[model samples]
Target chain A: MLIDWFTVVAQAINFLILVWLLKRFLYQPILDAIDAREQRIAQTLAEADAKKAAARLERDEFERKNRELDEQRQSMVSRMQDEVSGLRQKLLDDAQSAAERLQTKWHVNLQRQQQRLGEGISRRVQDEVFSITRKTILDLADDDLEASIINVFIGRLRQLDGEALANFVQALTAAEAAVRIRSAFELTDEQQTAIRQVLREIFPADAAVRFDCEPELIAGIELTAGGRRVAWSIEDYLKTLKDSLGDLVREQDSSQGTPTAESESLA
Target chain B: MQLSPDEQVFWQYGFIKLNATIVYTWGLMLVMALGSRFITRQLSTEHTRSRWQNLLEIIVTGIVKQMKEVGLSEPQRYLGFLGTLFLFIAVASLFTIFPGYQPPTGSLSTTAALALCVLVAVPLFGIQEQGVAGYLGSYIKPTILMLPFNLMSEVSRTLALAIRLFGNMMSGAMIVGILLAITPFVFPVVMTLLGLLTGMVQAYIFSILAAVYIAAATQGHQANPDLATNAPKAHSQTNGISHG
Candidate 1:
């Protein structure tokens, strides 16, 4: 009584149709959408992972290059330091050598200046000594200084002995011309006879004698025969005094260790 | 008052009469179909979606999960038959809050039709999973003498499924109707609320029982041994509820 066969059949068909309708409109589309969204999310995640890996690689490469650059800069700085040190040492050596050369040149110039000063002092001493000695000799003696000088020269000739006596005797004997006598002043006839008699007594019997006047002897007398002469003059004594003063200046310079201005000029 | 929607005839041509049961069933069907079509018209595959689409997906997936729990390997394959059963029954019961709305499920004809559909679907799905011979051989399981008992069990369980749903839905509607006459205001509203709760439970029980039968038919009961044992226990309990 509760069941209606016609209605049951109709409801069963209706339910079946609803099943088909829901499956088409609802389940299928919803399932597909979910699947699509999941796939899109997965793809995005994969791409993000790839980009992360690439970024890591790039960072590593950049760090490697930075390390290499630091090493290169360090080496360059060390090399530059080494070159600077070497250059500094070379400059120092060049400066030292230049200073030594300048000192040596200065020493040479100092030595040349000293030599010129010594030559000038020597010349002045010679002129002053010669003039003073001639004046003193003429003023101190009451007789003519030229006659006194002549007598002193004759006395030196008479005192000759040994080799000097032999050489003088041989020169007078071997004369090709007459033995000649010269004096700073003119001789009177009596004085010339006296000198000729002395020469005749010392020479061979065939030897001849002559007399002449010369003034360059500076208050002295000379006898000449066969290119040999016996003479005395104030010029010889002046030369001996100049040599003694030069030896005193050298000894003083050595004791002092360094050259004073006077000692350097003298040297 | 009519005890069932079947007695309320809208049109008749002898044995072929259009009744309240058929007319209300069509209305429910049309509403369900149109609602699904309208919501799914511009379904977005994007992250943001319509709230209705969300609601629908939740419902469909929930049904799928329940079927899966029943040991159905691929729940989507049986989704059309099983999901519609729950939706149709629940929707019919839910419309009871409206004045003068007669739920089609309160009629024995509609419940029987749903149960018959489950009966036919069980064999169809079993035959689809295993050949006809393999499916038929299951009746003679354990011995040849058990074949008659197995066939009787199948028919009885299908009868049980139909009558259980019909009794729960009809009793709730009938109790609300009888209470509305006696108390009129407060008691009938409370009973109606209670009827709604009972209707939802019956809808769940009916659909779940249908799924269990399908699972057993397809030989998937072995997959989840717990479900296998629990399903029959629930059947016996619900059978007690229906008898009372």
Candidate 2:
């Protein structure tokens, strides 16, 4: 069968016209909307990216600050520890030095106290001895018979050696028999000659002598020859003086818990 | 040539024959359209001279500019429609040089169908862009007294486009056919040449009118009244249509 040219022509024209009309109205508006939507989407994506970047930067800054704070705190603690250590060492040194100084002071004080005590004790002993000697000397009288006897004995002392005679006088002054010699003996020539002969035999010639007589003796004759004195006495005054002094020394020694000659002699 | 008995009977039956020349012409027209599309695509390649690209750029730019003048919100949407219409009409005009090939646009039914599609689509688009009320209001625009006239004008313009394209192409085809039948050879050549020029001009006129009508319907008549009025004049001048 032959194709219809008229129908085909009519159809082609209709198709072209329809295509034109559809393009003018429907396609244009849809395309415009798509373009607007695309632009909006792009803008939203860009804004989101910017916000994310800002957040990351803020977090990084916070971390950095935290790290710095930690470092600072550590440094401060270390510094404090160092200072404390230094202070502790200094205190220790100061305490040690103070202890040493106190020890030295204690030692020096102990030595000085010991020396002072020793000196005071020695001075007290010397004062006691001097007081006793003074009391004994005051008891003697100038016109006493013992004084006359001492004067007669001293008059004959020129025949002795000087050193020996002085020693003899010291011994006579200490003797108990000298006191009896003053009262019991009126010197007869023969007795006096006999004492002189004994004195000459005991001492060197051309010596001066000093004699002391005590009346405390009951009866005695005493002759001082050189540095030595011989006494014959009925009284026990020497034994009594020795006994009292020994008792006093023994009492002192017993109180102090020390050994002495008095206690040894008594034992 | 000896005729067989069955062949003779078949010849005597007076059955309608397919016109070889008409088929050849139609085929040539199709080839021309396809070839033009191929050439345009090839010319778009990187190595082609800038002139071809410049030519296409000028055409696209011109269409965009016209759409802008018409005050369409987005002109790019209409590019595909305009490009298709331009290509179709250009290929349709080439039918003039092919003997016995009739342009499809020459038929009244074809033109009327195309016009009807445009008529229906325009109001639909207008209603979609603006509400139905707004679309109706546009018909009565400028003054209420001009409402009936404007409404009639829209229908008449669509009718005019159908009649114009059909009359112009059919007349050219009839003229060339009559000339070929009477003068067998030499005079027919002159008529064919004249037909080519007429066909191309008529095709261009049809396409431009279609573009103007679309621009008016989509953008609204009030958007650019001056441009709407001037578009048809420019079409006539370019196509050498001396409209009295």
Candidate 3:
């Protein structure tokens, strides 16, 4: 009695119509809008992530390049320092070599100068001794030394053996052959006659004789026939004195442990 | 005074009688249609919205959320059918605050029709979700001998849903009418307020029970998804009839 069939059918139809209307107007549009907004948000997040990744990559690359540049700069600076150090060492070696060569040359020059001074002093001493010997002999002779020397020579001619007398006569055989005599002093007439008598004994009586005075011989007599001649002088005694003096100087130098140094020739 | 909307027949043409139930149902439908049309005329997808549009959005969203909380994984799929059912019942109950207003849900015929709609929709949704063979396969579940009992259960549950709403609404109205007769002053007003609260509760209960049956028909979906998904705002049971 409570149920009405017509009303039930009517209400079901009305409910169905309502369902259709709300479906078309309400649910569809709102769901679509929400989905669209969610999709937009997802897209924005994805873009931001990509940009962040790219920026991180760029920053890493730049830092790597900067590190490489810094390393290269350090390497270059080290190389330059090494080069400069090497150059300094080389310059020092060259300077040391040059200084050693200059020292050797300067030492050689000093040696040469010392040797020259020694030679000059030795020559002056030798000349002074020679002059003193000549003056002493001249004062002691009182102008008789030349006559005594002639007389001694004449006597030595008389005592000669046959072979020696024959050699003296053989040298006088040239057509223009002559005898020349030199002495440290002038000869007198008596001394010349005696020298001529001694020569007559060995050569023809017409043989010419020439006489000359040479002070370099010190005090000595000299003889000549063609290119043959004989002489005597005080210079022989002076040479013996010089040899004895040189031996004394060498012995003193050796005892004192002095290194041998070159000396210029007194000659 | 008429005990039911069915007995308050305004136009009777032989076996076919036009009653207060049909008229009021039509009037409620018209009001719903016109209001929706005006509110949805110029909808905007921008941030700003008209007040009516905002109200409609709240209602539609609330219904969709409720349907999802019930069991529908895709709430929008069931929003139209379920939302209309809820709106119709709630509107019928709510308009009672006005003088001389009678709710269509108080009529046994209207409540039966609503239950019939659920009964029809259950198999249709079941067949759509699962094939005809699969849907029919649910009857023989637990044992092959349970097929007749399952069929009986389906018919019995539909009848129960219709009768429950009718009994609750009609009893409230009857109690208020009786109280009006006895005291006729402040007691009737207090009973009317209590009746409104009961009507709203009944509307919510009827729709949720219908959703449970539909969820049962669908199978593989939870009848109350709040348990499975751990949703916080779960609907508490007024009566435990929805356990099926």
For each of the candidates, the C-alpha root-mean-square deviation to the true structure, in angstroms, is 6.9, 18.7, 8.8
Global fold similarity of model 2 (TM-score): 0.40
Candidate 2 lDDT for residue A151: 47
True contacts kept of each: 0.83, 0.11, 0.58
- Cα lDDT tens digits for candidate 2, B151-189: 897888777767766667667666667776788888878
Pull out the clashing pairs in model 2.
Answer: A10-B110, A160-A207, A164-A226, A168-A227, A179-A214, A179-A215
lDDT measured at residue A212 in model 3 versus the true structure, 0 to 100: 92
Using DockQ as the measure, the top candidate is: 1
Q: lDDT tens digits, residues B49-135, model 1?
A: 899989988998899999998778889999999998999999998999988888899999999999999889999998899779878
List runs of model 2 lying over 4 Å from the truth: A1-267, B1-73, B231-244
Docking class of 2: incorrect
Pairs in clash, predicted candidate 1: none
Mind giving the per-residue lDDT tens digits that candidate 2 earns over A137-201?
43442336444544455454445676865676566455522312232334555545545555556
- Per-chain TM-score (chain B), model 2: 0.70
What are the TM-scores, per candidate, against the unseen true structure? 0.70, 0.40, 0.61
Answer with 1 or 3, whichever has the higher DockQ.
1
Count: clashes, candidate 3: 1
